[model samples]
Target: MESSVPALPSVLLKDGELKDVEAKPVIIGGMVLDIHATPSVPANPRTTTPGKVHYILGGVARNVAECMSKLGAKPYMISVVGLDMAGNLLLEHWKSAGLSLDVAAESGIPVWFEPVSVVKSKRVVSVVKHITFASPNEDELIAMANALSCGEVFSPIQKDNKKNKCSTESLFQMLRPAIWVLLEEGIKVVVVTLGSDGVLLCSNGAPGFMKGSSKGSNPHGSGNQLYRLVNSSCPPNRFFSASKFEGGSNLFAAHFPALPASVVRLTGAGDCLVGGALACICAGLNVMQSLAVGIAAAKAAVEVDTNVPTEYSLAKITDDAKSIYFATKMMFCQSML
Candidate 1:
């Protein structure tokens, strides 16, 4: 049967002129709203301090799309905003940013806040959810887990039961099942941001094809079916590595620590990571390489107060990430030996 999906646009004009164009769209679905916040100040329980207030576009899905756009990908936003002045302004901003807003519409506003302290710590508190936002409910999550676990949803949940606060294994245990389920559902790739632990990723297969495979080799051959896991370091020096597991692999995992940065704010770091990773993948980079780019994007985001970068070069970031990845890998291996 014929499909309605249109062919991806070519990188040439109809007149046979060479051009650069991206046809693949990264559709981000979630909340959209206007954010108003005061500059960073000392934390006080019962005092009001004078500070400058600023407003900008904010939301999980929206920030992700913005990051993707900055990373040089075509992003389509599927979200709802207030029907008032804020919504109208948001639509204008999206249009100006070159995003496809055909799926965007107007609705009610969802308010959020950003609070920073003298120590430079930040916290975001969500005040409400708009009717039009698309967030997965508990039922859906449970169903996904069940399907992934092959009907083991009701099994006894494992608790970290550890007093140590810096336990990545404990945290990984808590997140592994859900991520595994998503990958099992043919998600291709799943990334989990673990605050202090850095980022963890799961995938069904390596991007592109197995390394060292002969010409005309099947990309999906059994040699590439190993499960993988990686853990990246956190903060001081963001380092990462991966391990491959043998068997009929259903999932692979890896982690990379946060890159060094003078963090101004952490507003939309996670969104930036997701958007960056997706953009790299769409650009034909492997999952591991895409993750490196994601880390670089997030590092750039925290270097400024805004959710997305005002100026960035995707090529430069990709190159920097590759260099850092190789250096970190060398250091990691040396330490292990």
Candidate 2:
């Protein structure tokens, strides 16, 4: 008898929905954990408030994966968990939620509390080296910025003078060179998320598109080209030349406003936004449309306590995107005035 070979898994796209996608799983690599917390307002010092304690699945990357799974996308979790009951339960929960955990591994449980916060800090200089190695989205970029500016990460400015002001703009300016360096590594898009202020989108060109000269002479060259910033919501006539490289491509930048929404808790909103945006992208939506969907998902996420969204909530986010899309267009037009 002849030996039989296993068939490779395939992903299918239909009617703007990613179906039966076993191979093309959204790989989320980060922390994963079960969070136990007591609800307390103002969080009185040294006093235990009378409130109901609850346990929930929590973690940046894990939450993102769960939200993506809820939004009908196959998400694969790449995380380390402790060899304990909590870890076992967390893994079981992920399995029940239809998330793929083949990439997850066993390790020590990373726990934290109010007084003792998680202290996973790294230098900005070192972080930039890792970030430029891959194409990270807006939320991930913002997280890095937060880590750098919050005094958690070591900074030369902080070392030189503790009183030196460290605004977000200053940090971005400092990191601009690092962002430019990413271009040499084939990174075409750089998204910066500004909470409530909105998102700043920077791109050299569409992903996978060949770099060409703006003069319309050659179709392909040494990957050096001029790039223009086009507001997704603005009229086609409006365009801004961001910058140009001598023998490379330029970077384009644009800002989009955040949609208004009611808030109950802001725990997993960013994760939801990232997950929703990625899912929309996988479903073949354009960058702007995917962003709009992400904003809508975040709006929905803030209204709920749980990080994992239900199917109904995901559908509601899709419905909310329609209105948010128009609102963004109006906001973009007003900004141009």
What tens digits encode model 2's per-residue C-alpha lDDT throughout 17-56? 2222222333434545646566656577798766666777
- Model 2 CA deviation exceeding 4 Å by range: 1-23, 34-36, 39-48, 96-185, 205-248, 327-337
> How many pairs collide in each candidate, listed in order?
11, 2
Best model number under lDDT: 1
> Positional deviation of 207 in candidate 2, in angstroms?
5.6
Worst ten-residue run, lDDT, model 1? 1-10
What TM-score, over all chains together, does every model reach?
Answer: 0.58, 0.57
lDDT of 2: 0.44
Candidate 1 Cα RMSD (Å): 12.8
Q: Note the Cα lDDT for every prediction shown.
A: 0.45, 0.44
Residues 1-337, candidate 1: write the lDDT tens digits.
Answer: 0000101222111121112222354353444564665747875878886677777677766777677667666655556667888788788878522233222212111111111121111110121111111111123333434544556563423444457464555555555565555555444334455544576554553322211112221132111111111112111113212323333254455556666778898887766776676554344333455567777788888888888888666555655566545543211111000
